[model samples]
Target: MSRLRPVVAAAFLGLWFLSLPALAQQEQMPPPTVGVVTLQPQSVPRILTLPGRAVAESEAAIRPRVTGLVTEILYEPGTALEIGAPMFRIDPTTYEANLKSAQAQVTSAQAALTQARTSFSRTERLLGSGTTQAQVDESRAALEQAEAALQSAEAALTLAQSELDWTTVTSPIAGMASVAAVSVGDLVTAGQADPLATVTQLDPIDVDMYEPSARMLALRDDIGDGRLQLNETLQATLTLETGETYAATGELVAPGFTVSTSTGAVDTRFRFDNPRRLILPGMFLRGQIDLGTTEAFLVTQNAATRSKIGQLTAWVVRDGKATQVELTDDGTWQNHWIVTDGLEPGDTLIVDNFAALSEGATVTTVPVTLDENGVVREQPAPEAAAETAPAAE
Candidate 1:
């Protein structure tokens, strides 16, 4: 019995020793450490990001001005064209013949006019001698008729010249031309319904951006009157579909005051200089326009959550515990939420350790910083830490 008793005591003691480490761990364990950012209310620009579409500043459908068979395409397809630049050479054979005929008529009219003038001058000088008043008047009438015929012939010559010139089919505007719609030997008529090609002016491109009226309902309260300046409202930036930002800034060309009944949105147009041709017509783009600055607290996007109902809620550390609160967000500016209400100055906002946090959960905040990608680290980067550290004595 004594031998069994010693064995039991040793086994029990071993179990107790094994449990001691776990008890000590529980007793010494601290609360979950969280990364928090202190809220400092300041002036932030109210930026609105909206979807928009690109359009050419000016588009022209080029059709034939003269009727003839297309003989040669003078300009290359899909290339830049200047005003009065030849695009196509229509068959000018018939036009050339008409021009020659008109020239001959003008020459004949000139000869007839000279003869009539000579007769009229001789008759008027001899009116009191051999020539009677009626004869002189008849000569004057013939001279007037010749002059009229000459004027008519000259008018025909001018028209013939214009037609012959039009047979060259020159461009009327400077722009980029689309592919030729008609090929060689295609017979085109004057003022035809089908266009020969399309020219689009790309520089100073225009974009139509739609802003929903519902979004404007809160804008009146978000931005104050004095801050909304004419120049600031005209300024805009664009982001392409590939996630690359467009280099040039756009200017507002047209501001919308009326909302469309069907779309319930306001259409605003902005113009951008596109000398590089990076932005083409019919491209989808996203745009950001500054609605002026407002006094608000900027919260990192990582610290806030949006509900299915679109309510923005964030966790703020208060009284050493996490307090989940709803925030009034105007929008986003530079990857941060522009919070206008529901947060007080100097509030500690939990940006990291979200998974370990709950409503009223006790937490110990650690001084931390977020990287450009919003990843939280225990301390600021070395460069930032150096700048913030006190200077050496």
Candidate 2:
């Protein structure tokens, strides 16, 4: 029995020793797979994004000068109208009768003046032939009174003609118009506060946007140094929230002289040729203005992480080990970072598996591509980037 017990104990010891190897193997296994990126320098755009609103280049409110019931509406919404074209027809019968009465009065005054002139001529001859002076004077006074009456009648006739024309509401300017208020047969009183329609010149429209004052100052410096083009119009495209592109190129108008106190931004104007009038006034649009060449740093966005102190940080790989780097404040990239500090050239940055990573940890390195959402993308090497740069002529 003693010999059997010794053999059993030896077998148990052997099994325990075998299990130790497996435990060590599990501990030595690598961490989970993650994405990574490298730090490098490339040209980045120094663009300032801001909100903007569209407005018409020229607009006129169509209102009536005289009061009457609307007889007809000759214009429709989105219709193009010419200058002096009749848009609304008011009741003109009343105005027409007034004009006719004024004309008759003018005729009656002219006949009285003719009779007075004939009497004056006779009186003048009698005075020269030794007729009574009192009679000649009285005849001269009657002629003068008749002349004043004729002038008053002519003034009245002109006023009546003007009122008749007001019954036909004509467009003051030539352009595309919008139906604001009223339809056919709607009573439209003259001198009423409300407008009948609104006309806008849509071929060339304006967009007003605001940008930070700091960005504007920097842009001005870039322009002066030829790093950016200034006072020159650039082709711009507007993207609506619905992802539609407005089919027009915009020109940069003048920059605003006043800066906003609340936001510290300056209003800037842009002019776009909207020949089709597809863009409506008061619509919001996203504008892209390309200010040529700027000095910027380029690094993968994955490499940038935020520190507990509310600062952006990155895990820069140095000598095959991870190191924490706090990126500078002035940083931006298309999907990367134009870091100001905490990074140098030839540094490899980790883009994935950062939560469990610790300082000085050794990691396997790999190149990573950034997707549109700035997430790490493991991809094969790009042939385009591998091509040698062309020599400067």
Candidate 3:
């Protein structure tokens, strides 16, 4: 028993001796290294993303003016058309005959007008020579009646010419043509209830963006307090259904003054140039409008944690130690938090290796930067960065 006791004691002593070195190594190890970005006040763009719908700038429904059978369809469906371009031709046979009849009447009226003037001149000459005053009066009355008939005939002729021209239905505006609702040989009436076709102007398209009224009110307050500065020009960019961004930048054409009763939002209209006809009417889209600039710290979302109660907190290196802070952010910008408060300039915002961080713990910070794509990358060394920099002009 004594021999066994001594062996156990010796074993314990050797194990303790072995663990002492490990304990000392752990104590001597340096603090965890974390990548951080130094805080600087930058003019970050304040963008508001909203749902929008594309609308045509102008649209027209084509209807026949002259009541007749549709003889020919002049315009091709889904093609561009200019103002006064022919779209449908009504049967011009009846219209042509009516026009010819009007022409004959006009000629007859002119001939009668010439004869009446000559007769009136002769009556005036013979008024004092073997011509009674009563007879001259009758001649003058006849001339007047003939002149009135000519005027009436000319007015009818004008109407006939107009009706003939109306036989060829032309476009009232320049736009893209839609399919014909009525086919050839179909009888149509003037000012009918149904349209024969449609034309839509789509090059310079309009987008109606709905913005929440509450958010707009918040923006107004922020702007009033000088928390945000408006841009010189209001612009917006669109994201298509396929998640591709549109190439054209839209301008604010109309700002809403009335709120929608059903949506709790206001409709702001934007105009965009779509020469390729990419945007059509009634297409739902996503748009990000450049509201203005606000002086705020942009913190990466990964560095921040939100509490169950919706409180945002992040770890930042302050005085060479990790410090926890409660952040007040307006919203997210580019997948990052637009922190409006609870941070100071020159603070080191720990981005990576922060899960293991604790309050008041010493931290080693490595300067890092976010690229154009919001990707975290270690900052280039001073000499290497200088070498890659563009030369002075």
Candidate 4:
């Protein structure tokens, strides 16, 4: 019995030693489950978003044409006024008195001129009837002097009339008027540094935006290379400061033909209809311009990560292993990265379980589905999952 016990114990010890290697192997990690998407080039609109400011199409400063006391303000401040509309009324009493004085001088000069002409005619008749030549010459000189005096007087009268007409200040344009600079009873003058008021055209306002010159050149090159196609009518979309899109679209009026020396950017202007007056001059806004359509590869943000040095990278799955790849992204489109390089069509991109993956690590890839909104969702890979499952004893 003692000999049989030793033999059985020896057999049990050998079996336990063999099972240790199998248990150690079982503790090793299996392939990590990962969600992946197949790369497919898509046609997407190339859009450039930039900051801009709304500006009035035309602006004019109102100043008094004559020096006088401001008697009354004719138009309401901040209200729309048409061209030739009265804006202010200066006291016209002084201007009227000046005009009357000028008229009196002109009347006196007319009487003098009539007298001179009569004398000259009588002298000429007397000279023909044997009167002295000296008398005729004196009458002719007197007529000339009188005519010159009348011309001077007429000019003064015209000046006075103009001054009188300028007493009533009018708007030079059709637009909204600013507040009055001078109140009633205040004496204002022509050629003053300060303006009486300001008018600004609001409807069909303009927006000025600046874009980097380098970026614009690059876009043009791409278009020339046939990599991108631009629309015939270049229109832009506006976003207000409150993040709401404006109802009316704007057309690009003046493209940046010249680059700014200081800012290294080009100035572009867009015109938008402002019937509701929602967009005001000097208001800051955002603008999106569609450059054209281009072929690009779209990947979810989760599938890509930024390195510490700001370089973008992603994991591509092939032959049941994940390979790390550096990527160059043009920009973001609908919450996804628009990759320009570092990936090709038919490459499997790891969308989820990226934190647990490394280069050359085996991964169990599941297909990812995207909805119309570009939202990524995981789908069960039944065949792949079943094949990778543990077999029954």
Top candidate when judged by lDDT against the true structure: 3
Model 4 score (lDDT):
0.89
Which candidate number maximizes TM-score? Answer: 3
Q: Write the per-residue lDDT of candidate 4 for residues 231-289, one digit (tens) a residue.
A: 77888889999999999889988988898899998989999999889999999999988
**In model 2, which regions exceed 4 Å deviation?**
1-38, 93-161, 173-180, 183-189, 200-204, 213-231, 260-264, 275-278, 306-310, 328-334, 338-342, 352-356, 367-393
Task: Please report, in order, the local distance difference test score of every candidate based on alpha carbons.
Answer: 0.89, 0.78, 0.92, 0.89
CA shift at 376, candidate 1, in angstroms? 2.9
27-119, model 3: which lDDT tens digit per residue? Answer: 998999999988876777899989999999999999877899999999899999999999999998898999899989989988988898888
Expressed as tens digits, the lDDT of each residue in 116-155 for candidate 2 is: 9999998889785877889889999999999999999999
Tens digit per residue, CA lDDT, model 1, 29-111: 88888888788898887678989999998888888888999999988888998888888899999999999999999999999
Write out the backbone clash pairs for model 3. Answer: none
Off by over 4 Å in 1: 1-32, 100-155, 220-233, 257-262, 379-393
Q: lDDT (0-100) at residue 137 of candidate 2?
A: 91
Q: How far is candidate 3 from the true structure (C-alpha RMSD, Å)?
A: 5.7
Model 4, residue 143: C-alpha shift (Å): 12
